[model samples]
Target chain A: MPRKTTIIGILGILLYIVGCYDGLLVAPADRFMGDIQRIMYVHVPCAWNTLVCFTISLVAALGWLLSGARARAEGRAWKWDELLEATTEIGVVLGAFLVVQGMLWAKPTWGVYWTWDPRLTTVAVMELMFVAVLALRGFVDEPVRRATWSAVVTLVAYVNVPLVYFSVKWWASLHQVQSSPSTVDPAMVLPLRINAFAVLFMSIGLMGLRTQLARRQRQALLGESDSDSTASSGGAA
Target chain B: MTGVMQGHFDTVLWVYGLTTAGLLGYFATLLLRLRASKAPTSGQTRVSAQNPEKTS
Candidate 1:
């Protein structure tokens, strides 16, 4: 995993450099928004990846709950708890980053940092729910209970993601509808694609590192040896 | 010309500022973590050197 992360890191850096050069040096600015259109390359990708992270987290939480029940019934003993923790941690970090980036994008495009738009408001609520899940984990000391409850929160909070995505479409709003990839000019779209790939790899890499760190912390709480062979269960509290 | 130019100016500044800040924040976090990971190893080395007699 460490080797894989290193390789991903190297690739991420190389791609990002190439991407920046393409965005700044090679591509021409938009006639409409001019230099500001360049913001889409970064802003749009962050938004997409943030949604992607949340969706993965929701699926992982559901998988954990189902697998845990099966493990208990079959007496197979799975480590779904660790999986849940890792997924939630990744979800929260990416979710937070998404909002920060969105606010940055919004302040310019909308003429305000925040304006009670449905999509923005719903996404903020979803991000808060994620924080609540983490707080719940912190308050619960018992491993099994923490994992089970957090999984539940993650699963429930996931319903808001679609609401956030569809809010602009369903109501009057300042937020722009998603750009059609087919119609995007090649010069503009190329950097956007590269940025998306870079951010995705970077997000995954950070999540992988966080998962391992969370696992380590869990082991320490359980009073286990520092060896990698130590079993990982609920350790968030 | 003035009205159209003003319209784009604030938006352009806002986008650039926010995106730069976001990217910087992420980069700062990575650096902080890297620093933290190194601290323990460096501390252990210092401890061992300072108290070689305590080494078992």
Candidate 2:
């Protein structure tokens, strides 16, 4: 685990350095966008990472729910539920940042911070769903119950991600369709492709770190309870 | 710079500023929760009583 973390961390740092330097310095300014288009380097990566994180959360949520159901029948739950919770929590954090950055990018390019365009609207919905999942976890006291419900919600809400991606194509929207991978020139593609990889690596690193922190907290909390139980029983005896 | 340039720069700064603050707030919350989770229980069952879901 430590090795995986270190490798991902080093790769992310290198990729981020190359991506930021090349994107901000070597890439050409847009004909229409001027210097403001530099926002794309950061904004686009955040957007991509959000989607990736959300998809991972959705998969974890599915595992949580399915495994939990089996565990309920068998009267045992494995330790994997903690992993689901950790991933979903990290995804929400990254997803929230993505939305904020996307809006920031919009203020300059789209002339308003927000629009009711399909892509933005769908992403907004997705963000809210994440919020709901977190709120649900806080509401329930039973770990199993919380895990089951949050997992269910996470899986259901994940359907919005693809909708958000396709929204620009499916309907009229202010946000520009993907220009780098498909229609744009080779010059634009270089930075974009590299940046995408950089963000993916960074996302993995962040997710791993966040999940580790979460599991540590879970262990600490459970350990405290076990100690308290033992102490009280001894006193009673 | 001209007024338009100043205006655009102001918007850019605000966007980055708010985002930085938001991220900081999130990290702080996570750290605080983590710390609370590790606090010793002092042979008390209040935590589980207070947070029953966490217990069973």
Candidate 3:
């Protein structure tokens, strides 16, 4: 691992410990939900990072599609493609957890493990869409075609991201509106803010590692193609 | 802090415990995949040719 990533990984661990301290012990409990409300510390941060990862995937998808033809042909454009893969995979993982966390939080407050509410439904659909993107990428045999198809799928799937965010407001639902500094108690916001950055740093470090793996796999695949073509050319000569 | 509130702290524990497990589990999976990709195999030579893996 790079020194910078190592530093970030260390920083993330430290911040997570501090954030847990504040969130679990220091912050006052909500009068309504009481201590169970503390779940928001982890639940909310997972939600935030889920959206962030998908947004990053959308940008990476755009990068892969918009790069010049020469860049694509020379295999230089695989960076964006691999990044798209990494972020999409990470987003799907985070989104799955977000749903479970929301369910856990909801059971105590809403009195049900789940409902067909707008927010929860949209998030479920969004997670499944990104999961399909990962599955399709694995199914394709050709690298360029796999990258292109998944990128296009990512673009289409991103349409649901905004829907997921707006679902709570667009219609009556059990889920609360977005949390903010103004809305939450001053003491509560401190831990929320800390954990948000903690999750962000950890996600970044993970993305870095995941992207490297994607690149390495692509390189191996492409190298096989190169070797095959080279042998054919030599035989012809 | 209230007696009733203390009764439901389990909800908080559920999310905290699950989220920690999820994050750590994903990180472990990622590291294992990366390690698998680095296995000594025919593809290792090809991957090294594109851009050298960080030696430092």
Best by lDDT: 3
Ranking the candidates on DockQ from highest down gives 3, 1, 2
Error of 2 at A20 (Å): 1.3
Instruction: State each model's CA lDDT, in order.
Output: 0.65, 0.65, 0.81
lDDT of 2 by residue, B23-42 (tens): 45655665566556554453
Candidate 3 chain A, poorest ten consecutive residues by summed lDDT? A228-237
lDDT for each residue of candidate 1 in A146-185, tens digit (9 for 90 to 100): 7678889988888898888888899887887775456588
Best by TM-score: 3
**lDDT-better candidate, 1 vs 3:** 3
Q: Per-residue alpha-carbon lDDT of model 3 for A1-237, expressed as tens digits? A: 656766786687788889988998899988777898888888888889999999999999999889777666555677788899989988888888888988887876778989999998999999999999999998996777787899999999999999999998899988899886778999899999999999888888888888878866765564534223221112211
- Give the distance in Å from residue A97's predicted Cα in candidate 1 to where it truly belongs: 3.2
Q: Scoring model 2 with DockQ, what do you get?
A: 0.16
Error of 1 at A161 (Å): 0.9
lDDT per residue for candidate 3 within B25-54, as digits (tens), equals: 999999899888853234545665766763
TM-score of B chain for each model? Answer: 0.52, 0.52, 0.55
lDDT, model 3: 0.81
